[model samples]
Target: MESTEVLRISRLARIDLDQDEGARFADQLTKILAYFEKLQEVDTGGVSPASHPTDLVAPVRADRPDGWEAPRDLVARSDGHTDEFYRVPRVLE
Candidate 1:
């Protein structure tokens, strides 16, 4: 796709991409989508469903009780605090 197409996608997705970066990203995305198209022609004949590639098992450890507790003064140390959330200036604005 061209930079114009990438710019259209950026606008639709609520993103800001500069000219050079948008062109580069368009090239990379074209290549990645081509790879996915290649993957569409594959056949999964006899493969088993797996979470990992290897069959190694992790060693088990004895469970222990947690011994720590939070400070009783919850909001006493806060500056711009709310009921439960802390407010700050928007980072992207």
Candidate 2:
């Protein structure tokens, strides 16, 4: 990567880089891009693209709400509560 390209990228990212920093980032980005090019050369004819390595599927429980009641003592303690519900300030006009 050229220093000019690095400066352009820094400008796009809203990052202020000095001449020395721009040159350093240019060298680092060049090396990173070279590593990606090296990876592209690897032959994986049988290998399939996967988001995760394991074939295991995540277990999902039923979405139905469980019967649970709040304590009456906790509700009575709140100053802005009506029965079990807390009275919050209206967000929308």
Candidate 3:
């Protein structure tokens, strides 16, 4: 990034940067972009995109018998309730 471009971006982002600060940011941005350019040269044709770098799986929980009285009691105490669902006022027209 050139100092001029950095200053323009800073102005657009409502950031105040003097000429020296803009030049410093330009140098840092140039190094960061160069690093990204280096990463672009890597071969990853066989690699699949992932949300995380590690392989993780959800833990399985053992099922136990539970009564339905809890939900019944909660609904009985609630201010709004129907036979199967709670009633809420329309929030949008």
Candidate 4:
């Protein structure tokens, strides 16, 4: 965490750090590195990495065909309609 190293890192990261800010960040970076070093000493040989900590499963629903249809009155009110669908302008080329 030397001043020269801190200044170089700040420049590389596109940050403006004055002398006092650089000194403060140096001390904070030292502590953060120490914490990561401590974390490295932990035993996690049997633990598996996961997106979430818990073992979760998604619920499935039974699928059945429902004879649902749009009423003719609704279709008659539309600006454009085919036998099976409402038509609109193409959105993309």
Q: How far out, in Å, is residue 11 in model 4?
A: 1.4
Every model's TM-score: 0.44, 0.45, 0.41, 0.43
Per-residue CA lDDT of model 3 for 43-64, tens digit only, reads 9899888987778886777798
Winner by lDDT: 2
lDDT (Cα) of model 4: 0.83
lDDT of each: 0.79, 0.86, 0.83, 0.83
Per-residue CA lDDT of candidate 4, range 1-93, in tens?
677888888889999998789899999988887877987788989987797767778677889777767566587689998865788999999
Clash pairs detected, candidate 1? none
Please list the residue runs of candidate 2 whose C-alpha ends up more than 4 Å from where it truly belongs after superposition.
Answer: 4-19, 64-93
Write model 1 residue lDDT over 1-93, tens digit each, in one string.
777889899999999998788989999989988888986577877967799888999887879876655433465456765655665777996
How many residue pairs clash per model? 0, 0, 0, 0
Model 4: how far residue 49 lies from native, Å: 8.2
Candidate 3 global TM-score: 0.41
